[model samples]
Target: MQQSNAYIIIFSVILTVVLGLLLSGTSEVLKPIQKKAEELDTKKQILGAVVPAEQISRMKAEEINQFYESRIASKVVNIAGEEVEEQDGVQVTAENIDVAKNYKKAPEDRLYPVFIFHEEGNEEAANAYIFPVYGSGLWDNIWGYLALQTDMATIEGITFSHAGETPGLGARITSPEVQQRYKEKSIYSESGELVSVVMQKGEGKDYSGEPHKVDGLSGATITAEGVNKMLKNYLEHYQSYMERKKEGTPKMALN
Candidate 1:
């Protein structure tokens, strides 16, 4: 009852083609849904920089999108702090720019996205400015959104995420308790020097009296160092834009 070799080969080819087409069709069908989910997650993270974590967690996906659209405006800026209408002929906006991909490029060549948070009805004045930062963690990539008050020096809130890090240790960067510790922290000194906040060597120490210091993770020294470097690096990257804004320069209209 053995089938001929030619019959077996033909049957295998047909099965392979059929399976490939099914997978391709399924992928095409799911692509948009996957993209929407990714977009929603990004919105949630950006909102987390200013909104309370519990509030964000409680909101539905549609509500999150509505809130983001009404309160957030954004623009892309270059390393020199100039508003860029396009990059390499592609019109890039803050929402669409891939911060992780840009992180792979040289600092001077990367496109920086600034998100401006205003009241629901007031777009003329900003309440806070959120900057996205990316860098290495103990095991993989770590990133966050840092929101500054109107003065553009003090942190209003922050939310961190990582690709791969030890749970209960480095991954604690995403904990709301950890992020809240950065609230009201300053990234500049009294003399106007850009001295970004630092996560000291250990945790449980009091940094309340310190403007530019935060308590580090107890057992994740490497991850703490990663966060410190990310904060300082991105703050410096955005320093020129902040200085211009502080100097009464005209702001660009949101895209």
Candidate 2:
């Protein structure tokens, strides 16, 4: 016996709806796990700014959370170096402030998230202040965090992540050797100016002994330029926060 066309159509629709519901239910059930994984990844990236990527690789999720919770303190500040109490009627905090979203807002209105890291036992003396930055690269978006030492002028370290930079070239920004070049670079000049790091072309040497110059990718000039611009743009956004720290202001206290 052959089934009628109408009956076949009805069966097909029922099967499709059942499969769709099953898939949706599975996704819903795994939503919490997915969110936890994302949070772990973010913590890893933030910690990567200061800690070596290899070291971060060895850390467990609990270790990351413990380190971030016990050693690192987060604060939300405005362009004027003032700690924000509330924004749009919601309390301002580091976890809630979206740097990418704030990037699109007006310069003065943007909210900045500053993560201050300290040694395990020393909370009073901050080791570094980490800032997150995002920008367009040669092929896609590039982002990373720059950690400035307590002095607020010298860079302690940095980490870069790109969406689709060419392999072995612009992608090398994430390589240990490339990121190490930024370790001791100073963002401030002798005259106390905000001269963010520069990625020079062709062996990218600081022949002039410039404090803020770093070696750029040999053939990936566009991506290198993107890193340079991204650093400057984000650093300038946090200038007020750094300046306040430099002035020994008591506005930001460790939590």
Over 147-217, each residue of candidate 2 has an lDDT whose tens digit, in order, gives 99888988889989999999988898889889888888899988989999898898746534667888778
How many backbone clashes are present in model 1?
0
* Clash count per candidate: 0, 0
**Per-prediction TM-score to the true structure, in the order listed:** 0.91, 0.88
- Looking at model 2, report the run of 10 residues with the lowest lDDT sum: 246-255
Can you write out model 1's per-residue Cα lDDT over 1-255, one digit (the tens) per residue? Answer: 449998999999999999999999999999999999999999999999999999999999999999999999998999999998897797888999999999999999999999999988687678899999999999999999999988888999999999998999999999999999999999999998999999998888999999999998989999999999999999999988998887653344333
Compare the candidates by TM-score and give the number of the best one.
1
lDDT of 2 at 196: 92
Give stretches of model 1 more than 4 Å off.
1-19, 249-255
RMSD of 2: 3.3
